[model samples]
Target: MKTNANAIAFIMEGRRQRFRRWILVTGSLAALACMLCCAMLLLGNTIYPVQEVIRALMGEQVKGVSFAVNTIRLPRMLAGLFAGFAFGIAGNTFQTMLRNPLANPNVIGITAGSSAAAVFCIVILHTSNTVVSIASVIAGLATVLFIYVLSRGRSFSIGRLILVGIGIQAMLNAVISYLLLVGDQQDIPAALRWLSGSLNGSQMDDLPYLAITVLIFAPVILMLGKHLSILELGEQSATTLGVNADMTRIALIFSSVCMIALATATTGPIAFVAFLSGPIAKRLVGVGFSNALPAGLVGVNLVLAADLIGQFAFEVRYPVGIITGILGAPYLIYLLIRMNRKGSL
Candidate 1:
């Protein structure tokens, strides 16, 4: 009896320690994200003071500062914040639910769906941004349903889903390439910018849909985080634990698909933000609590910081996606190599 009590006490203490670490790690990441946001506002070409930036944000027109801060940087910052959060949360949700670090939206073709739709609108349809955004969302959801159906035969298989998603993504990429090859030269530049996952020219008007999508669906994913962790334990274990595996997975998939689609539409997929956010958050927050929130914060930090780096880190300005791709490619190669060595690929 005493040994059992001691074991229970030990488990309790470990939980407490994990909780503390989670709080500390999450808080630090949030603080860092906020700092990066501030830098985004203040460290542009002209470099406004913090007080002037705050005043401009507060509706006080301060000589040359208000337009720059409110018109240009504010929209850009908000885009990074909300879109990054969306990517981060959605990526973490998919990874956790699928129990595979490589199961992010980027890898499994959800973002590719959005990308293909947006590219089609830009290159072929000559549509407005609004049309592009709507088409992207519809296509994203459709892609999820399509992949789900194709992977659902003879019991759901993670490997099969991933394989199908990869194949679809390849086909979509070919379509995009064909469109670009035959698209108008004027339109090709626009399509290329969007395809490269840029944050250039982010407008205030383009944000509400993305913001609303993230606001509505992020909480849904967060609420299902416990079920996500359980789902990570395998379908049989999840079912034995009284979790409705199929329903929970569908809910998570739907929620994640929505946010990531909107985000991709908003910021052109912002390369690898979704892919890298989850593992970094998981590493930081350990295992006691859900890492969705931390993952989102990490994502915000990545996007905002990458934007800054792109803006100031070189003689020539690059897009946020370029910076992120530079950062993420190495990690991806490393992950693939490790998985290959373990025969988990």
Candidate 2:
């Protein structure tokens, strides 16, 4: 009786620990995201005080502050925050599900698919933003399907999927380059800007759809967090645990793809926000905890922080994606070297 009681107490204690850890990590991330959002709104060309920024946000017509905060900064900040969250969640889902850090949407040709479609619309069709967004989402979904089908050889292989995705990304990038080379000079700049994953010129009108996508899909991912954790235990183990591994994976992939595609449409690819968020979140939260929300928050922080840096760090303004890419490349190289040494790749 005493042994059983002790086991029960131990299990209860573990649950309590996990719950506390979750709250701490998520709360910290939320606070950080909030701070960055405030900074984005307040620290522009003519830095407004927090009170003025708050007033502007509350629909007060505070002269200069209102116009700058509402018309310019608000939309940009919203786009970065939600899009970063989407990227972070989606990327972490892929990495966690596939058990490979290289399995991020950006690394695996999903964003390339969206970028290719958007570029095509800009360069060849002269399509509007709405059309570009629609085409990008469709292309992203199709790319995932193609990768899944091609990589399925009697069973799913993470190695095969990642390799095929990399190949597709290269091909799609070449296609984008070819289209640019043969297209009108006037459209090149617009296409290039989209490809670079920037948050500049983000408008209120463009934010609702992306926001809706995150709202609708993010919960689905979070709801399936338990299943996602199970998936990390490998397919056979998950199956042994009574988890529907295939269906759960498909559901996760679909939800993640939707979020990522919309996010890419909203702010291009945003460099490696997706790729870097998961590992960072895992490191911060440690093992034996769900890091989905934490990872999303990390992404939000990275995007907002990088945008601020790009805007004010240099004499010449750089895009958020450029800054993130600079930050991500070294990490990518380091990861590859470590993985090679471990013979894991």
Winning model by lDDT:
2
In the order shown, the candidates' Cα RMSDs to the true structure are 1.1, 1.4
**TM match of model 1 to true structure:** 0.97
List the global CA lDDT of all models. 0.90, 0.92
Clashing pairs in 2: none
TM-score of each: 0.97, 0.96
lDDT of 2 by residue, 1-345 (tens): 999999999998988887787788889989999999988998988998888889888988998999899989999999999999999999999999999999999889999998899888889999888888899899999999999899999988999999999999999999999999998999999778878989999999888889998999999999998889989989999999999998998899999998898888889889999999999999888767789989999999999999999999999999999999999999999999999999999
Judging by TM-score against the true structure, name the best candidate.
1
Clashing pairs in 1: none
Instruction: Give the range of the ten consecutive residues with the poorest summed lDDT in model 2.
Output: 283-292
* Candidate 1 lDDT by residue in tens digits, 1-345: 999999999999999999999999989999999899899899888998889989999999899999999889999999999999999989888888887888888888889999999988888899888898899889999999998899989898887888889888898889889999988899998788878877888999999999999889988888988888898999999999999998998889888888888888888978899999999999889887899999999999999999999999899999999999999999999999998999987
- Per-residue error for 281 in candidate 2, Å, reads 0.8
Predicted structure 2, TM vs. truth: 0.96
